[model samples]
Target: MFQSDFLRKFRILLVLVRRDYALQYAGSALGLTWMFLQNLSLVLIYTIVFYFLGIRTQGEDPLAYFAYVLSGLLFWVPLQEYLIRGTGILTDNRQLIKRSPLGPEIFLWIPFIQFLLHWAITAVPILAFLLWAGKLGGIGLPISFLCVFCTGLFVACLQSYLARINIILRDISPLVRLMTQFLFWGLPILYESKGILGKLNLLNPLFYPLETFRSFLLSGYESKAAFTDFLPFLILFLAIFFLSRARLNQIVLDHL
Candidate 1:
């Protein structure tokens, strides 16, 4: 009975994800193509500005530098979308929570699925580019994806807490947006990772996964340090998830 019920819920979640995806791009002139276009445009703009300014990674040719930036954005974009879009997810879906038999956790999956879809779509050209540049590796891709999945799980746990808080505060959504912008500049996205930023990379929660993804794509090798750095986050995620699971339903009911 439990297995059947779980399967039933999974089907419903897929429906919700598909509907949300369609609705998001419904009125856009370019529709889903805009997703690719937007990412490409940003890459081009950043590459032009940085290249003209004579910023180059040591020993890396121009193509490698461009790949580094592009690879970094691959992880960054999805991470950014997850946090910003998920901030008010529960509040945004209050009606569904009130009416639907599905768990409130289903709302969290919607944004994650959307972000993954966007990332998958954007990765096609990136993967092709890496292959053409002779930088793609067989083992690196799978390992990089595993790291990304772990990072997503970590984000989901924290987002669960934030989503619950946002219901009462109402200010969290804007704050998260502002914070992500600051993080974008603070992270080693445009500049080469060296000096103080390189030292801090070991400590910054976002740096490991970003570098893991970037390094794997650019050099066909994953960073052992990144895997090690993620252990703390994994521990934190488990603690938060266990603590919050019991109380989350109650909080939602009180807020609704």
Candidate 2:
């Protein structure tokens, strides 16, 4: 049954992904090129301002800061995309959920897979940038790839659980958007974790995955250390995933 459900969900996800990819370039003059342009512009603006302000590390190379910031941004984009799309998934497909034979939970996977596809596509430029900056060496490659995959899984689960909750409580959706907006600054994306934690002691759990990811990828830090640091997050992610799956059907039925 699980296998059958998985195959069904995979087919639905593929259709959604195709639609999303088309929609992304439907009316755009530059088509899919806009994706690279958007990311490049943001990276350039961030690198220039941070460099001038001397916000980067003194000991590290100049490009190190750019690599660090880019790594975090890469991890962040899929996470943000899932959150934004997942929250609205149910409402947007209320007709299908109410009438179709497919499980509502399948809809949750749509946004998750869509974000994963976008993340894979975005990785091309990120790889080029890393190679150009001469940081793509040794342990960085494997650890960074692993960290990205793990972090993506965690975010997918987090967004799926949150989507169920948001459908029941409409206000929760906007609150999530506000929280993610605040988190862009609060999560140490553009700055070093040490500096952020030094200023604020009680760090949120949501930020740890990205911190661990950046450390492994840009800082060439040990994966075991980063994984151990986020053990609590892994535990929390599992608990949420199981609990959400267990109750998702009932939750969707009740909301309907």
Candidate 3:
């Protein structure tokens, strides 16, 4: 019974994932092919432009610099999706959510599904390049994936509240999008950290994990972070997740 139930839920989840992905490129003629290339094209644009600039994050090796930009965009794009799309999720699907009692819980997985798809579509080439560049090895690759998985959970927990907050405030959606633009510059992806901003990088909750993962992937050592760097963020986010989850249920039931 349990196995059957799990399988049923799994199939439903897959269908939802497919539907959402399709909706994203609904009017496009090529559809899935174009959907697959969109994220890769963005990464390629950044990689080519930066690699051509003669800026060297990994000594003078151009390939390593390519890997650097590739890895940054590979992760950063989905995070932007989570913040922007996730905040408006409730409002976007008010029709479905209002009909199904379990709506919010299920819809919460949509952003995560999109992340997995984006990663999966690019995973082969990304892993191959990392391998060819000697940036990943046996357990190292799995560890990198672990970092990505943890990040998925972090964003889901975060949006648990952000989604609810937007339903109430409405302005938060635009604000999140605007701030995300600033955050991209803030993250140490495009340039090396320097001076006051570099010092303040430690305080940004997203900074440590991303920096640690980047350093670990490139050089196999974490120069920018310790475990405790993101611990407080995790703790606070979990607390907010639980409280917000309860309140969200209340708001949906009582108001929406």
Candidate 4:
């Protein structure tokens, strides 16, 4: 019974994701093709500036640098979707939430569902490039995806807390956007990783997964240090998730 119920909801989730995707591109001329083109264009801009203008990170190899930037985008794009768009999930769907049989907490999964879609879209070219460059190892790709899944769990909890706060504060949306911008720039993608910012990655949780992704993509390997980083980050993520969850009562959520 439980398995059937879960499958039924999962089916509904897929339908909503399709509807949302269609609605987003409703008025566009190219429609779905723009999704592919948009990412390609963004990749080109970064590649041209950093790879062509004599600026480089990770290495001087064109393929490696491009792969490096693309790898960073893999983690960053979904995160932007999770935090920036997810911050507004409750407020934006308040009407549906109030009327729907399902609770608002069910809607929190929308951002995460979208994250999986966005991550897949971004992963294609990275996989292609790594394969073309002769860098993709069997385990590396799967492990990288596992890292993404692990980190994404925290995004849900963080989004839930932030969305709740946004209901009362109203400024969290913009604050989240602004802070996300800072977080991207602070990442070592644009600048070389040996700088002060790279050393400061111990505090930046995403850095662990990003670095792990890059390492596996580049060297086809992961280190013990990668495992070490994930342990502490996992602990921190679990603490935040439990603490935030305690506040997400159904009564308060419905009232909000």
lDDT of 1 by residue, 70-157 (tens): 7777778878888987877778777878888766788878777777776776677677777787777666567667767767877888
Candidate-wise lDDT, in order: 0.73, 0.70, 0.73, 0.71
Sort the predicted structures by lDDT, highest score first. Answer: 1, 3, 4, 2
Question: Which ranges in model 3 have alpha carbons more than 4 Å from their true place?
Answer: 1-4, 55-59
User: What is candidate 1's TM-score against the reference?
Assistant: 0.86
Model 1 ranges off by over 4 Å? 1-3, 50-54, 57-60, 220-228
**Candidate 3 clashing pairs?**
none
lDDT: worst 10-residue window of model 3: 216-225
The most accurate candidate by TM-score is 3
RMSD over all Cα atoms, model 2: 3.4
Count residue pairs with overlapping backbones in model 1. 0
Clash count for each candidate, listed in order shown: 0, 0, 0, 0
How far in Å is the alpha carbon of 73 misplaced in model 3? 1.9
Model 3, residue 2: C-alpha shift (Å) = 5.0
How far in Å is the alpha carbon of 165 misplaced in model 1?
A: 1.4
For residues 1-256, what per-residue lDDT tens digits would candidate 3 score against the true structure? 9999888777777877777767777998888788568776876677567677656555656776677777776668777877787777677766777887566677777777777666667666777777887876456566666777678788788887888887776548878888888878777776656687787676777787687667656655355656687789889889899999876777754545
Candidate 3, residue 120: the lDDT equals 65
> Residue 61 in model 3: shift from native, Å?
3.7
